[model samples]
Target: MRVSLCVLLPFVFFAQTAQYTKDIEVVKVGVIFFNNELELVRAFDTAIRDINELELDVRLEPLKHFVSEDDSLTLQEFACELIDNGVAAIFGPSAKASSDIVEVICNTTGIPHLQFDWHEENFYIHTRNHKLTVNVAPAENMLATAFLDILHMKQLDWKSFTIVYENSRSLGRMELIFGWRQVHKAGIKLWHFNRGDDYRILWKLVSSTREKNVVLDCPADIITEVLNASIYYNMTGQFNQWFLTSLDTHTSTIRSLNSRQFIAKMVAVRVRAYMPPPVHDEADVF
Candidate 1:
């Protein structure tokens, strides 16, 4: 009886510990940024601190590794480990492709994910909708609208548009639907739309673009393809600079971008205020 009580006592202690730990709905955060660069790392960390204020139970655990072409598998593995460790929610990896991987893991694990700006098909569902994914930032549709607004504001009356996209994931297709709506919003028209590799089609559209402009939503590696094509056709100056979406600002890609090679363009980006926890009310749990 004495040995039985001793063994039973440890089991009881373990149960109490697990139950206590599970009571809180941890708003777990996961991010994929250029971890080696202090600027990107610090900025990302500070953003999470602000998020902690919104929910008393929220916590952030940065996936230490960054995402690059070579490191994607590593990052994916680390993220799964985080999910296994009982993360209740996820955030960051703001681009569509990377976020899709996270979305799949969260769905499989029965955890909720909140991708910030980029929304993939069936991944983002609003909190009000009672779905697993949420997006706090503007959607790609909103991003396309912003670019169209820029054209209208500048009163660039080119009637034709060219869309460059990738379908490695479904994000490009989703954006195409929204981009057309943006064109309609500007009272303009869309021309040749191209998707996934093979930039030959774009040269054919340059004559049309000689009168208008084009929109490019290619990923980092593929952005160079459009840049080369625009230069090849000597249509670089024919239209407004190609527009892109904000994605992982990795070092190698930044170094690869030469202003002389491709005309400078603006991407859909956000200026977020990164604040730490409230020191003023540190004593109050509420």
Candidate 2:
């Protein structure tokens, strides 16, 4: 699960080997990301060390820019600064709106912009001309296909399931699933719920529905809350089955639900493993 990454942050250096032992070129790259996700920063740091050890002709000099979720102006300002400094590429501003602004700058400036996130909208798939934007996240179409395969593997009649999702991102995933209905042959029902303190209303609707098959596409925290409500509403029983869209479900432990030994069929998607970029030693570079 601890995969090395370079796509999350903008790394815009040419991958060329040095012509001679004396030639050394250090290319500057900019990484714009949220202040949170310190874990990603730490993981990227290790990736940097590995890259540096490669001793490629074009060494990477990373310039990090951290921004808040609400500050669109600051995100633009950071992109401007990175451009002014002649950075080869710009990495993030992980929020969708901010990322749009950053991508415009990258395209206009002819710099490659790398991004990593669950791209449900297909915004980062490709461009008509510049092709500057790149997303490292798995494509929504691929994920949709994988889910269908999972359903078939389980030999479950998942065609009549209800989709319980949280927020716009989850809805986007739901759309991906529905868009591929010709292949899946599933008549899916959708329910959208915002993240909040109370899930009683949502639970009531879910419990009242005749469909015992449920597909959940939400954050881990929201998943926990929904499962709690499912139990309270007496919705977890022999006739029901829950299919989780999140890869991290196996890692999640709902003690209350587990203690009751609710035996309704349950299954989850496993997260896709990420591979780090390849690194080469000085000799290999030449």
Candidate 3:
């Protein structure tokens, strides 16, 4: 998959106004992240390395800070520190609360801010004045429409289906799907899963409902637990069709959770266009 940073960085630097110096210099780019976002940090580092290889006059340096997503004061401090250190742009703190704090600071300081988190369309409409901020997440309605298209192509008899989502934020991603349910008068059921909840109990309830079509929207970290619970409940059979909304669903960890039987019945959407490498002969599929 093409890392968004790889594409966005060039535009960010080249679009600078005449007020900024045209002379070659080392440009510092700030990154704000949570503790669990090491993968994102690694990706950011890789992107910076790849960009530097172009041998452009402007060299790029990354300044990253790890902060608690809920710590508004600390996040604000970090943002100010990055700006004080002369960063041209800031990326992430993908969680909504922290992102808002950083975005406000960046806006006031006239520094560019970029995000990779999903947000409702109205957010952009309301924050039109914050022209320095850019979000690369796909629009909710667009993603919902894509999901509908995929369902249609699969030709599944999904008159009724259960939507199992991770949190309140995930609900925003489902708005268009909810509208579709209303329009079609489909029997749609909703289930919410929090991090500490018993996965077995959740899957048991779902299994008891005998719902053949299920849509799961959750972070990649918990997918294995969720699927393991479903498997324990015999919910991974050919008759059950699962659609996973996480882009990381195609990762090796997730793919390893599927046997041939499970693979045939499950569908996962990812950002990349490429298909996964074929399962190996000796490797355990489950």
In order, the Cα lDDT scores of the candidates are 0.48, 0.67, 0.72
Residues 121-211 of candidate 1: C-alpha lDDT, one tens digit per residue: 4433433332555555555566555555644444434445545445434344344445444554553334443446457666656545452
Q: Give the per-residue lDDT of model 3 (tens digit) for 1-286.
A: 2245334744556435212776746788888888777777777788888777874667778899988767888898999999999988888777455346777787888998877766545566337545677776666777877777666653565778898888767776676667667532457788888987899899888888787888898887788777877877778887888878876665537767757546437777766433445633221122
Q: How would you order the candidates by lDDT, starting with the best?
A: 3, 2, 1
Let me know the TM-score candidate 2 reaches against the reference structure: 0.74
Best by lDDT: 3
| Root-mean-square deviation of candidate 2 | 7.4
lDDT of 2 by residue, 1-286 (tens): 1225443333323563235433658777788778886756776667766777874666778899888877888988999999899887776655344346787778888888876556446443345433787766656767777776666653575657788877656554455556645422346777778778478788788777676888877766457777877776666788888888875565466444765547677777654434344653211210
TM-score of each: 0.47, 0.74, 0.83
Q: What is the Å distance of residue 246 in model 3 from its true position?
A: 1.1
The TM-score-based order of candidates, best leading, equals 3, 2, 1
Lowest summed lDDT over 10 consecutive residues: which window, candidate 3? 277-286
- Candidate 1 Cα misplacement greater than 4 A, ranges: 1-88, 92-112, 121-132, 167-201, 208-212, 238-241, 245-286
